[model samples]
Target: MEERVWTGWNPRLTTVFSVAKTSTSLQALEAELNSSIACEIEYASVYFFMPETCKKNIPVLVKTASTPYLVVYKSGIPVLNTPILCDTLTDNGDWIVIQRRTSGDVDFFKEWVH
Candidate 1:
């Protein structure tokens, strides 16, 4: 796997509050993430507030390794369900890793159904 180093948060980008908790298992983390008010970005490993809520695009740090990411929700805040957990950046959470894919492991031409 190719390691992508995180240089730090950009000053111009909108801040993303860390709402993730430390999870003991992948299932637990998935459940937490799905219930939080966040969305996954394509290049970054961290979750950020949804575009509709934030009203702007927020850039996050990238992590290339396979890891579990945590999620937490404030009381009374609406929870949104996001089932898929594919990330392309390094995460800083304490959860079990369920699946990992190295470079060239995915077949782009193959039809995948989950």
Candidate 2:
């Protein structure tokens, strides 16, 4: 058996990942992440408050600059097709840019992650 680590948390969500597994093949891990997202959409509704068909209508936003990973309901996405910046604060309190892939149906991912 392997150990799982809690990386981050949303108000009503918990993100658990295996430390040993994440560094090996990021693509495979991402596949696992997609599956986990799908599962959460299927079994849990405590966090997902949106309607089932809503995800299809929402646009997937990718990071355009190095910004904090804060979810803002009113922020506008960049007009260009750019990767989303996954921002994390530095030890000295600076924001660093992290790139991430946008996946899942907007409705499903939003409910599952938020």
Candidate 3:
């Protein structure tokens, strides 16, 4: 699959698309991402030290500016919205931005990626 999709722990929650799969539509991509997020959330509390719902309520401050938080990312998303991902550094307090590298990045889809 040319589409680079990964769901696992690499210091933080990460899911990325290595290459776009023309065969898959955007809807399909979102579904796949949701699956990844869901799987990670199920086990995230143990590593994040917060409950599934509690994670979002707590706004963390990261000096590094790049903290991978899957549970929190998913929480902010609405039940029905095409997820947007952007690979860049953003200065939004309590809100995180992601860079596009593919293999090792935290919350690569925290914002719209282009």
Candidate 4:
């Protein structure tokens, strides 16, 4: 038997690629991700969030020239589709912005089910 050195927990690292202003639709976005070598190698799962529309049953905005959209990946597959109000800003690739506020129009203080 050989002596073994114990190293602390080494979590598997993953990369998230964010597209700011390119994709026009979900299909387009998926195509782009499929074409990207980096995404293909790193992808495990993805979550897509789109801006909400006022119309009762309108389609969500997948990408915009001025707005930002996020694509989260894990192990190697796409897992979820949700809706968000604003764009996400990843600070120094360490933190993900879930929401940003510039006005009091939308209330942040609400119940969990709200």
Candidate 5:
């Protein structure tokens, strides 16, 4: 698999916040994200949401990487795919995920993006 590097806080939730894919409103997304931070799921870094919510509601911020990178985040999950893919995100330097190109699916980090 290929790799992409994000400098800093590549908020995956924020990146897709523009399209509003959640059953709840923007305020809800905000609340969900904020509340989830303390109540994170077993092995998940981010909660899952619909595509519309991700593209229309989340807000991505520009930050810096603490170290060099060879991967990016896949909606709070890490990826090891191509750098040109927009759906992929990157945090400090711990994990990586790969974006699915054909299906345009973002949920493959756990199943196939390895």
Candidate 6:
């Protein structure tokens, strides 16, 4: 198991979002994430439409904050996998998600290069 970090934001929803791989596979991860975000964020939606083409119909503005990383995980034995942290985003740091990308059916993140 491995992990990667993605940084981005949804302006319409006004939620700062990022994604990282947990010990468990994406099968249960999506369910867990949707369930949690629905409960935690007041009006936030985790609209993941095939990473690269996330809600293209809607628009978003990228913004960065300085606190609170909302990490959600599924129930499974974490294999202590070392996640591939994107160079664009930092551990527990604030960032905006420009777009989501999937490579060979594996979801990953990419940060906007300034």
TM-score of each: 0.14, 0.19, 0.21, 0.18, 0.15, 0.16
Q: By summed lDDT, which 10 consecutive residues of candidate 6 come out lowest?
A: 49-58
lDDT score of residue 72 within candidate 1: 24
Q: Which segments of model 2 are wrong by more than 4 Å?
A: 1-24, 45-114
The local distance difference test score of each candidate is 0.35, 0.41, 0.44, 0.41, 0.40, 0.36
Best by lDDT: 3
Candidate 1 regions exceeding 4 Å error are 1-66, 75-114
Tens-digit lDDT track of model 6 for 54-99: 2222232331345222222211227633222121245433333333
Cα-lDDT of candidate 1? 0.35
Give a tens-digit lDDT track for model 2, residues 49-112: 3221112223334323554342222223556333233233444322324444497534434555
In the range 1-114, model 5's lDDT, one tens digit per residue, is 123434343466566674555544777878889887757652253223212122322443432355332222344334633232232334422333334467765654485546
Question: What are the per-residue Cα lDDT tens digits for candidate 1 across 19-97?
Answer: 2223336668787787663444431233343121211122323322344332222212256443333222245322222
Most TM-score-accurate candidate: 3
lDDT of 6: 0.36
The deviation in Å at residue 63 for candidate 6 is 30
How close to the true structure is residue 84 of candidate 5, measured as C-alpha lDDT? 24
Better of 2 and 5 by TM-score: 2
Candidate 3 regions off by >4 Å? 1-24, 50-114
Kindly give the stretch of ten consecutive residues in candidate 4 with the minimal lDDT sum. 8-17
Where does the lowest 10-residue lDDT sum fall in candidate 5? 47-56
Cα deviation in Å at residue 103, candidate 6? 58
